[model samples]
Target: MNWFMEFLATGFYSGKLPKMPGTWGSIFAAVLAYFLWPSNPDFQVLVILITFFLSVVSSDYLARKLGDKDPDQVVIDEVLGVEITFFLLNPQGDLELTLAGLILFRIIDIMKPFPIRLFERLPGGWGITVDDAVAGVLANILLRVIGGFL
Candidate 1:
């Protein structure tokens, strides 16, 4: 059970990579989103919501196990964030849009603007997960706004 939790918390070992584990996890998720994301928006939302729930649980468990506040190696949050980004901006799996979303999400996540950073103050899995989700939502909105101008 710990092994399985660790596997999930680490984003299938992407988090164990040399550096920027969150970026790697998001990249992995983007690839999966490009290749396998469903077409229906309802299903897309469903998937995102399910991933969100799992990410909270997995990240919470891993954080407690590691005795860290938002451990660098726990990147299920990144996976969920990237999935949310794709769901909003590239639900049809457009490679270009998905790439754009990936970049935007990474940037917003790193920058941690305003309330995004605030979400991290929450307890347990909520802290680990909600910040990235907020970043994803912001990235999605930012991308859409940018696309409107282009």
Candidate 2:
């Protein structure tokens, strides 16, 4: 059960990487988003929503079990974060847009500015997952707003 919890938390070992585990989890997320999410916008949104819900629960459970405030090993949150970016911004799976969202998400996620930082202080899994989700949303909005100018 401990192994299972870790497995779910780390996004199947992506987060176990010694360095930049969160980034590794996001990379895993990008691949999953590219390959698995349905082409239909509505179905794609559903998939993203489902993944996010599961990730939150998994993260909470792992954090509590692992006895960490927000276990660094729990990077399913990163998957949720990046999924939010791609789902909200590039539902069609445009490679360029997806890549852009990835870059923006990484920046905001790592920087954790303003409300992103605020979100990180929430209780349990909410603390672990929300900061990145907000970052993804910020990235999605920023990308869309910037795309408008291009």
Best by lDDT: 1
TM-score of 2: 0.88
Q: Write the per-residue lDDT of candidate 1 for residues 1-150, one digit (tens) a residue.
A: 999989998989899998899899999888888888887889889999998988999999999998998999999999998887876455445888888888999999999999899999999999999999999899888888988888
Q: Per-prediction TM-score, please? A: 0.95, 0.88
- Candidate 2 residue-wise lDDT, 1-150, digit = tens: 877777888999999899899889988888777666566779767876776777788898988887888877788989988887876444445677767777888998988889789887889888888888888888878888888898
lDDT of 1 at 34: 85
Worst 10 residues of 2 by lDDT: 86-95
> Cα RMSDs of all predictions?
1.2, 1.9
Residue 56, candidate 1: Cα error in Å is 0.8
Candidate 1 residue pairs that clash: none
Where does candidate 1 stray beyond 4 Å? 91-93
lDDT of each: 0.89, 0.81
